[model samples]
Target: MYSWHTQDYLNLAANIQKRNFGALLLHGAANSGRSELTNELIQFALCQSPQDLHACGQCSSCILWREDNHPDIVLLAADNSEERKTLQIKVEQVREVIDFASKSRHLSACKIIHLPDAEQLNISSANALLKVLEEPAPDCIFILQANNINKLLATIKSRCFKYQLTYPAWDDALKLVVENNPDNAEFWLRYFNGEPLFTPPFENHELTQLKATLLKPGIDAIFALSKDLDPKRVGMASLLDFMLKWLSDLFLVKHGNNANYFVSDTSAMQGLAAKINNDKLFALQEDLVFLSRWSEHPLNHKLQFENILFKYQQIYV
Candidate 1:
């Protein structure tokens, strides 16, 4: 489905056939279709039809893939699902992968291991895996996916075939949105980090109300929530994520990059945007890593966020 837009990546994959590249790195922001592209490659490697642009979905291998039982294709992420969980890719997961690598494929011609979010691996775990990447088995292919390539080690980076996945143009992403879920603009825009191929549920009346409340004075919203003392930790965390995404959009618009803004008019956020620069905007984005990790605990949420807002105010001035 997403293959039509990934011509360049497919061409690169074809080139690899002529001259085999042991490892390929797929790096991109969230929802930029990096995983989809990896899936395409896996399909091509195991596909019964050997066409440049198309994978025959009718083949036995393709049928197996659709059922999530492709023997040669291994996806070793922290979780099998796409949702980001608050845990590292433990040594046990790597051990399973190692075990899989030890054996040959059940049916396919080549063995392929796709590790999405490889950066989630801890130090010892990553190092142990590095040896496999360094001297991979002759018939094996390793594709590493990372959202923040900078988080990976230089040595690890050097050992792979790499490409950065660029965001599609605004018009292109908008077209994707219309084709899928045309009604839920806000949630999709925020969830995929401005990638339009994403479909996040926005029909939830609670999210709509939460968004409206956030648009009020920032400190006022905080104080009002404090009064209610709602213990819906999940909802509160989602609110924080939504607000941060809005702020990120504002920062982009302030720098004359409104082309990327999913919010129709970012003019109302001018005051907030003018208070920060590119460097500060990047720092604020990094701060979100902490927010995402600590927001589940109510005490940590209040205490940490108070300090975060305080520092943000200081930085704004």
Candidate 2:
């Protein structure tokens, strides 16, 4: 389990045991404890002796879980690694879950399948998963996690017990960040908006450079970014997200408010914001919104980045 969990998880876990729900969907923003809480539920389900709705840490099932040797549980998520970044849940992987479910449990009384980012399942794979959920195994449970559930198919959403998680308060989030990573804790915390589970899309130095260069956006600078713009190496979505946040902060700075995304670059933000008229900024925002609509699709990533660079260059023109 994570360092923080609300009583909501506890109540839900209790209800899981009480009702024996076949499927549960945990939806939340990035860096919330959705994955950790899901693991806790897995352990609680598999534990031969659960105490107070939590897994008995010393139990054999808990030991297997700690060792990451729980055969009965499978995690299906986009690896987002350098070699193989993907949002699509391949049909073959979904088949594995179905195959795994058809068999008997190995060590525990429970079997679980966890799908992180259920919205990433493409049409075929989603249909494949839907079939499994429609006729799940007697001893199995399915846990679906998504940061944005609206992208999920209605059929998939309808099959599960959905719960949306909330972020911790600033004091609690800061405490967690500092306790876990003291050095550069404040910087990273603010960068991720205090999501402990968040993995930075780029290194600190790279992000800083990106911010500086975008503020002085020129053709050469835009092309310099485009040269290394493969989504696998550095995500287009993350870049767009950064741009959106930066624009938001710029808008705030224009109105005599402090910058949020560029938390350290108040003067730079003010200067940049001053250069652009509201009409130009609004036009950029419209383009970004259009790009975001197709950002997750395979075809539009490069096109979106191109549009963003063009728009960024125009902002200062």
Candidate 3:
């Protein structure tokens, strides 16, 4: 846990001191520890041995939270991933939370609803929550966590206090990787797009080979590059994320701000960055970002990627 990143959350906690009807919306990119922080706050609220607002680990509430059985904490995720595929927090879930908020704490001092990935709440669900958020109960506090706040509606957004959780600097994230695997730090750092800390382990050789293909010149090389990764492997999505970031770094450098660019860290990447133009880079990034969101659908990912790559070839050729 990066204790430093929790400062914003701590401040939110402090601001809500004895204020029963407030909301905190925490937004962050993936792997930013939003859920973990919510859990910690839940513990603090329930902890019997709070040493001045901080949870004491040896306390009864801490023991309950540690055992994964906190009655006062209600959590709703997009999907069970273990079973159900409720793509968003449904209106029913919001209604339940509202009802629970109206009642009172059965055991814990405060009732907390930790809504992870809250942006996935559909239109009806957001409306349902808005009703309660506009007039929350005296003993209730809502904390909504999301990766992209733009996906949320303005009405819902206006009702709650907002906080954005930013990722640590690349150097700091890289340091953690170096601490565990001294030799593979740089390797994994590049593979994970400088986010080596939270990325899952996989075969580096595969992505390296794919990067080689993409870096080659000509339309055939571009097509080959897209096909080589197969887009079917479990690691393909991660590979595309890495590739997009690499291209983004180049895109930044091409626009004349190479001073702090990631690609500028290495001479070879910097050379590659020099060959690309900002216009192509911008269009490619937009296309990639669009495809990434749509990729979740039951579409032919290879065909989708090929179409995008073909545009690159048409322009770069």
By TM-score, is 1 or 2 better?
A: 2
- lDDT values, one for every candidate: 0.67, 0.78, 0.67
Clashing pairs in 2: none
Task: List, residue by residue over 71-186, the lDDT tens digit for candidate 3.
Answer: 77778656556343237777787777877788867766677887877877899988888888888776677888877888889998898888777676777777777886676577
Better of 2 and 3 by lDDT: 2
Locate the minimum summed-lDDT window of 10 residues in model 1.
226-235
TM-score of each: 0.73, 0.78, 0.79
For model 3, the run of ten residues with the poorest summed lDDT: 259-268
Prediction-by-prediction clash tally: 0, 0, 0
Query: Which regions of candidate 1 fall more than 4 Å away from where they truly are?
Result: 79-85, 183-193, 199-237, 245-290, 296-317
**By lDDT, is 1 or 2 better?**
2
Candidate 3: pairs in clash: none
